[model samples]
Target: MSGIDNLPPLREVIATHDLAAKKSLGQNFLLDLNLTAKIARLAGDLSQSDVLEIGPGPGGLTRGLLAEGARRVLAIEKDPRCVPALAEIADAYPGQLQIINGDALDVNPLEHLTSPIKIAANLPYNVGTELLVRWLTPPAWPPFWESLTLMFQREVAQRIVAQPGGKAYGRLALLAQWRTDPRIVMELPPEAFSPPPKVSSAVVHLSALPAPRYPANPATLNRVVAAAFNQRRKMLRSALKSLDPAIEDHLHAAGIKPTERAEQVHLEAFCALARSLDS
Candidate 1:
């Protein structure tokens, strides 16, 4: 039995392993091999890329990646119950699959990959956002992964690709848009999962750019964006008061209108503002 044909259908695998979705772990296993395969394909040409997956409950998505002919797949699973099932995939693929049993947040994926990595997973809801932020802000230039294709609550996916003035636009949009091109590749309704979540889900694909769209210190930009969006309803003249008592000076320097609300300012303006604050 190989990674593709050896394992029972995901349903039987889940049943055999007694792997039910756990709310605390944000577990929502996608048993539809077709859907999982579709998600994997959205990563685009994985044959030469090392794929990193988080929360591979019962190895459903792991099987999909391996079958798709990824050069290698490194899956991190927190639930001990699913480890054996994932191990089964590892055993089937021999040198193709690596299973790490731990919270994904604590393990740095960069340590495991060489280069030209692509991350694909049906992420656990609770830790998804935190993991994205970590991937977004690595210690230096040229982050480990070339692209990220992961699942998120539909609303969160919208936020990642949202425009400046939309309700969903906030720190996430700014952070993601600043350094990468993020888009919603597909949508999955709640019923797609075994224990369906209350909210619908969507898959987001983010490909890293050669460099940030605007040149500003990431640390400064993060601080400025976080503070500005903290009270998005307020005008920049008011919301950015802490950045500088003379908000108009910063605004004028950044070429942004002082009357604009946090959500009204474009990413370029945010980077400009951060640069102004730096000086």
Candidate 2:
């Protein structure tokens, strides 16, 4: 679409500036401008919102977000080598773009912008899950961002959206489902990157709920899920022994079978177990 910004194609921007993907930084540059724009579109309404992007290796998706009319973009990049290249994009876009050179985990994005923020990123593989966990569990009641549109290895994406009774379903799925409606919006093969990753990648769109659907302590739920799924082969009674001696009684009170495996238990059941632990 003509609404697309005038930033040069990602490949030209990379070659002109000599930006190569650095493995140690967990960088894999997405060089397709069209694909980047598509990702921006799938992130939902951004006209009234500021966008926060983590690990924009060469500004491909960063440019796309600006083109799609994000009110403002606060992009955090860990790699200093690509700072000048992103600076060029900032020059082209004027006041709409702000680049911060720092680790995303350390930066408080909410401090930089007020509410109505959407975090969209082709997050580095190494830190993607950790970042999502932080956003999903921020201390505030309603989170700062309106939504999260993030890229991850397809396997990780599956785990995020996985249903109960599946191999991919576990702690990640429980935490995500506890707060948001998450789904897979797009898939990218290995060839989409400068140095293609061994695995395929997928974009996940997660819209936060007003609050968690089930009421339970986050700490107990995390511990229960971790232990239950860790020894998935064992029955819930045996698996939950590390938690409390009467976990089996709690399971029965929650209407869950004491013989059930973690994968067979649903989110509500997990919440029940967590609540039971508190009793």
Question: Each model's number of backbone clashes?
Answer: 0, 0
Model 1 lDDT, residue 76, Cα: 91
Give stretches of model 1 more than 4 Å off.
1-4
Question: In model 2, which residue pairs have backbone atoms overlapping below 3 Å?
Answer: none
Candidate 2 Cα misplacement greater than 4 A, ranges: 1-3
139-256 per-residue lDDT for model 2 (tens digits): 7657888899999999999999999878999889998999999999999999998899999999999999998989988888889999998999999999999799888899998889
RMSD of each: 1.6, 1.5
Model 1 poorest 10 in a row by lDDT: 1-10
Candidate 1 residue pairs in backbone clash: none
How does residue 164 of candidate 1 score in lDDT?
76
